[model samples]
Target: MDEIVKQSLVKWPNVPSCTGWLLLDRRGNWRMRDEAAQASGAAGVAIRHEALLGFINRNYEVDERGQWFFQNGPQRVYVELGYTPWVVRLSVDVDSALALHDQGGGGFEPAAVFVDEDGGILFADRAQPARIAVLHDHDLEIFSDHATLADHDGSLSGEFHWNAQLALPLQGIRRDDVAARFGFVASPAALA
Candidate 1:
């Protein structure tokens, strides 16, 4: 959390939280939902301001109820998730090995891998399984290069080789069951 935001919280501790006004899209963009866009059920305009993005990222956190929000100074601006709480990009690090990084620019060490019916890849955090991360679409080819697939009992199964020695097994998962299976709420406003 930012020191300024902490000071604001102390100065005004009773500020009500705002929900459904911001969204973290599947592609890792922070979108600002206007009233018109919300009423029409459309994805809001992408926020491209670097400084604002940095501020939001610095204060982004999850509540005890598993709701992710950005503490905008004093008020908590709840975020609507497009997919999982995190969106990770796959890249080859300097050692020519697979690496995962979350949208917030944090390193993600995945302990489990899941593949949806649509072939979308999701990774579960090594320390916290509930903290799921979807692989950015642009990196699918990189993921494929490190994965080996096969048919097992009429279902798809695979292994993601992060390096020569570490292999994470990929399990089949349905798109609709992702949120429930992973213990995350896609729309915090609806639940709030």
Candidate 2:
């Protein structure tokens, strides 16, 4: 992991989830990838970086420690790390929509979107801590987890970390829906 990513993970130890990096090529194909790992390294095994890449391409069965990387044709993306309990940070390059979900409360809710200094989009909400599910077109589920939004300044730059949990199943979304604007839903939960 990069120094900044590592630092962010250290800052927020409670959120265990995956991090993603997305890009859209001129071909009109959307590319997305993400990394998942255990926050405390106890719930499941941790996947090696290279192994995670292999699983993404081969569609291999992954244990809790495995990470994933994927590309929708011209769109090239990879999840360098599997699933963790911490937040998965993302750096988006365009104006995108995010869909969030609240698993604890059981349903999808509205979320907020912001731009970072790098021009990346940050989708988040702090009103309630909940499990989040993000979909681009009501079909492809790009990201999902239990996350808590943090305070953001106007800078819309730099990396921010939050506490999150990865508890969504991979098959939650279908694979054939047209790519639509993404949205986020939140369901608050009580922490033990």
Per-residue error at 68 for model 1, in Å?
0.8
* Candidate 1 Cα lDDT to native: 0.89
Q: What is the lDDT of residue 69 in candidate 2?
A: 25
Angstrom error at residue 148, model 2: 23
**By summed lDDT, which 10 consecutive residues of candidate 2 come out lowest?**
183-192
lDDT for each candidate structure: 0.89, 0.28
Cα TM-score per model: 0.94, 0.19
Minimum summed lDDT over a 10-residue window in model 1 is located at 124-133
